[model samples]
Target: MILTVTLNTALDITYRTAALTPHATNRVAEVTERPGGKGINVARVLAALGHESVVTGFVGGRTGDALRELLAAEGPGGKAAHAAVSDSPVTDALVPIAGTTRRTIAVVDETTGDTTQLNEPGPTVTPAEWAAFLTSYEGLAARADAVALCGSLPPGVHVGAYAELVRLARAAGRPVLLDTSGEPLRRGIAARPDLVKPNADELAQLTGSREPLRATRDARRRGGRAVVASLGAAGLLAATPDGSWRAAPPMAVRGNPTGAGDSAVAGLLSGLVERLPWPERLARAVALSAATVLAPAAGEFDREAYADLLPRVAVTEQSSQPEQESHATRQHR
Candidate 1:
């Protein structure tokens, strides 16, 4: 079973308003909500692929209850979430100490198909709360086949949280997949996770370089066994211990791009846990990410797009790491 840990979960509210303008009173054409956070999205994708996954994270107040309801043992979309080590499905009753669980508002402009996001600062995690969560983390990772420590560390939490999680997963003999941005990625790399899924910007933040391959290699050198970067429209740039490969979508459909990276992580980690080969795993990641862009919902990917793109993905292993950066920018129609 796959174990996912989300430090900061939320009731993601997405609105579709045509021609969204700042400070204007706009009527939403459509709206949807989901149990959102990097880890939760990953879990959702896993469930979609018929994988058994257990999600453990902080939940409080009514929003927390809603999240639990959505991830119920027999919840919608044919269930498969819940069923964690803890009985009664573990959504630990931890207070946020300030605001409600973060509410991310995605104002998707219907006219342009562009999405503008408004993110909350997220609930503050007290030191005591942090310590408590760590106890849960250790317990969860210890018995899991694989653990995914994902998303950003909320306020009041230490910056090195993912770093510590990497250590815990290693000690428990479980491969850890760390996915986050900025400092968390940097600190987590110090602990040397089995894999990291960083998009172009996060890769830049880690290596301070614009070159994707160079940044990826630097991240790997810093202790990541592999660095898989989501290169926007170009596709996925991955450097594993075995070798490197690039995966892209087929020249066909296009749509929303929200939560593509999270979907990619889910695809890659799920394959890794299944003991699939490196090329197949890379292809799965690419297919799933492309699917995500095709899905209209926020933090959700179109499953059909994934099916269509799977066979078309190409994965090639490089004989050696390049000394200089390769300016190859290939795109699928």
Candidate 2:
């Protein structure tokens, strides 16, 4: 099973309205709530794609209870939904804590296709709570095929949390993927994870360069075995030991982009577990990311869209000297 770690789990609530205006109240036309946080989102996508994935991290209080129930609920947007259709289901191995889990709100403007988000800082995790999590993670990591260390550290937790998790997962001989931002990402990269998935902005913050190719190289230099940088609508640009390549969607897609990155992580993880070639893996990652943007909800990918884009995603092998030439000068098949 693939293991995912989310230090700051959240109850994600989405609201839709006709339009959004500053300083004006708007009536909600639709509402949807589900379990979220980067790792949980990744686990949901992996489960949908028929991959066995176990989610681990901190969760507690009444909000945490709701998140767990949502994970196991039978109808829709839950584990039973995936279990009803597929053999692989998402497992919740979340640890309980003293503080209540946080909630994040996304206000979607249907008319303009824009989203305004309000994310709460998650519950503080004490040192004892952290110790308990480490114990749980050690057991879970031992039995997993691969592990993804994801999301932000909760309050009171040290910034080096992901770094330490990377070390532990690596010591267990498991292929580990680190997905996070800020100081957690900065420190985690130094632990030399199997892969690090950072979006363009996050990559820039880490490497001091907005240039995708340059920043990806710089990130790898810091310690990732490989770096896959998400370039939003431009798709993904990866710098790996095998070679560098850029994958782009066939056409521009428009929709809510909340969990697109998580879907990409799912695609990459799935490919790694299946031992697909780097180009093929990148193609799947790009297709999944595009499909998620086209999906109505976060973490859901339209299978038809993915299939349509799979072969159409433009994959170009990049040159060895990225610093010498711009990506626009690269050739494509």
Best by lDDT: 2
Candidate 1 lDDT tens digits, 1-333: 788888888877788887898887899987766678888878878767767677866666677676666555433333533322112232232334343577788888888988898997777777877777778777878888898888988787788988988998999999999999888889999899999988899999888888887788888988899889888888888888888887777664477777788888889888998899988998998888887877756556666767888999877666553723332322221
Tell me the lDDT of model 2 at 278. Answer: 94
**TM-score winner among the candidates?**
2
Prediction-by-prediction clash tally: 0, 0
Candidate 1 residue runs with Cα over 4 Å from true position: 73-99, 321-333
TM-score of 1: 0.88
Report the alpha-carbon TM-score of model 2 versus the true structure.
0.93
Task: Record all residue pairs in model 1 with backbone atoms less than 3 Å apart, i.e. clashing.
Answer: none
- Kindly list the per-residue Cα lDDT of model 2 for residues 9-59, writing each as its tens digit: 999888899998879888999877788899998998888788888999999
